[model samples]
Target: MSTIENLLPEELLETLRDRAPGYDEENSFFHRDLADLKKLGYLQMLVPTEFGGRGFTLAQASQAQRRLAQAAPATALGINMHHVILGMAYTLWLRGDQRLNWVFEEAMAGEIFAFGISEAGNDAVLFDSVSTARRVTEGYRISGTKIFTSLSPVWTRLMVHAQVEGEDTLVFGFLEREAEGITIKDDWDTLGMRASQSCTTILDEVPLNTERVATHTPLGPNPDPVVWGIFGTFELLLASVYTGIGERAVSLACEIVAKRRSHVKQAPYAHDPDIRWQIASAGILMDGVILQLEKLTADVDALGTDRDPNYGAQWFLHFSGVKGRATEAAKEAVELAVRTTGGAQYFRSSELQRLYRDVLAGLYHPSDNESLHAAYAKALLGPAS
Candidate 1:
């Protein structure tokens, strides 16, 4: 019954916006923001109503993330990892796999989950992993270094995947924070999204209990539910954050141009044709991104409910396209705002400066521009000969 507005009211957003600069300047985690959001039960917003959560669909959650990002992109991005995990579990559940039901239950109990899927040099992503998963008497002992492990400060559980030793299998499992053999490095310095504290995690023979193991699939592209769930939820939510950044940039541009006076013209810069063109162009780019995101998220919700047998065959094309487009749009829109806003935005004190840095981080996320184009090309030309 909780609406997105109720969960993230304007007052909270204003507070987050006020604190954003300090957090970025200090390069510290968004502990206060996380605490406030926790109090609102925002962390468990995706759990179904039967499980004592708001029972929000992915579409609704994506919209909420966009609003949150508009206030503080770093906080929204840091929390997005947890939501991505929840979304994946819900996606799989809707598809009739109950293996991740415990995820929702644990979320209800206030257990925060972090994503540990990225490896230092592993470009294959979900289809392959550089980490090794060795068979043990009880279950599996995974040993490798995971990079970009967001929510490193407060996660109670981490979802990780690794390639099985001497086999063509990739295993997915959850590792507890209290479990031995997990080391979190203190190095998380970055150009943007600093509040995320996405530190590098070293896993030295960490034990995954039998019940903790979630999925086992052959290496490389496959029709596994785990892969589908992660890709769908992650790409959509990540795109939503960048889209929010674009929204913020465009909004600020409008405010600045309307108030900023052009001495020569003796009027607000909004009357200038060039400035109007830049702002309008930004709006045009954002419009396409919003439409793409809405359509894709709605399709995901429908697919989850109806069990479409062929719904996901070419999903990579759409998912990667949205993320690529959104990131590019955010960056371009932020640049437009910066150029039109004049010299003030170049200073570190300017909020637009922080946005520029944060928007840059989107370029490094998975499904980068190259991958996006590749997906589209593959869809048209087939795999490389």
Candidate 2:
């Protein structure tokens, strides 16, 4: 029952906030932040207590992520990759699946896991993979280039997926960082979320042990736990981060207006009707986003062990919908804050300026606008004629 208030206090948040700009400016990973988080046992928040973790639920993780993102969006996002994997394993484990118990054991032993699923031009997402997995003596040899490999600088274990060659199946498993044929290109410079160090990873026949393979399902989406686990945890965690950004933007906006005076009446902009209107609009959007996020997470939590794995479409519909709405609301909130803050937010020194840049990354994550619309269309209108 370690709440975010106890785990990430105001002092720690201020420290993270202080270092965020420096990390962004240097395009460096959040080494110090990562260290502090590890020390706090934040990395094992999702693993069960018996397994040496805090045993927090997905809902708690979402709330904690929101608080963390409010201080440092990039740092929150970088660690989110680790959380997503752990959350996925834990979500399935809760439903009586023991396939990923090793994940918890390794996490308890202090091993860091990074996600390596995203590929260039692979819009099939979890349903398919452009990367090829050739069957070898014992396990499959994964050979493909993965993009947006976050935590590239320090990940100890990487979870990846690839399409098996000559077979209509997809293979998912882990690869050791020290394993051969794994290359991490030092080219993570980006417009925002720079501290994440989400670089490109090239695998040249990296061997994956058969024992480590988590899923070997058919080529397309199915009623497997892996699909729902990944989609549910990824979408909820992603939504939480953007919602945090929106909350912080409004908070900063309020601070900015309270200090700046209106030239027309020499009164603080907080007293101006138009300024209030803008803040109110952003507040309204954020409120709705938070409600949607909470409802979705709660529903996932309440799902019984007998939950139907076949109910994948409804799951995708809600998860992607919330993620899309959260990102859109966050972007609008940031823009509104910038407009109210006037020229001050235009400077690189301003946190709002950084948030404005960082919020743009949300649109590029999984379930993009196009994907969101497509999911909604398929859900409401049935498959296209």
Off by over 4 Å in 2: 305-312
lDDT of 2 by residue, 120-212 (tens): 999878889999999998999999999999999999999999999999999999999999999999999899999999999999999999999
For every candidate structure, what is the RMSD over all alpha carbons to the true structure, in angstroms? Answer: 1.2, 1.5
lDDT by residue (tens digit), candidate 1, 48-162: 8888988888999999999999999999999999999999998887777888998999999999999999997788898999999999999999999999998899999999999
The lDDT per prediction is 0.92, 0.91
What TM-score against the true fold does each predicted structure earn?
A: 0.98, 0.97
**Clashing pairs in model 2?**
none
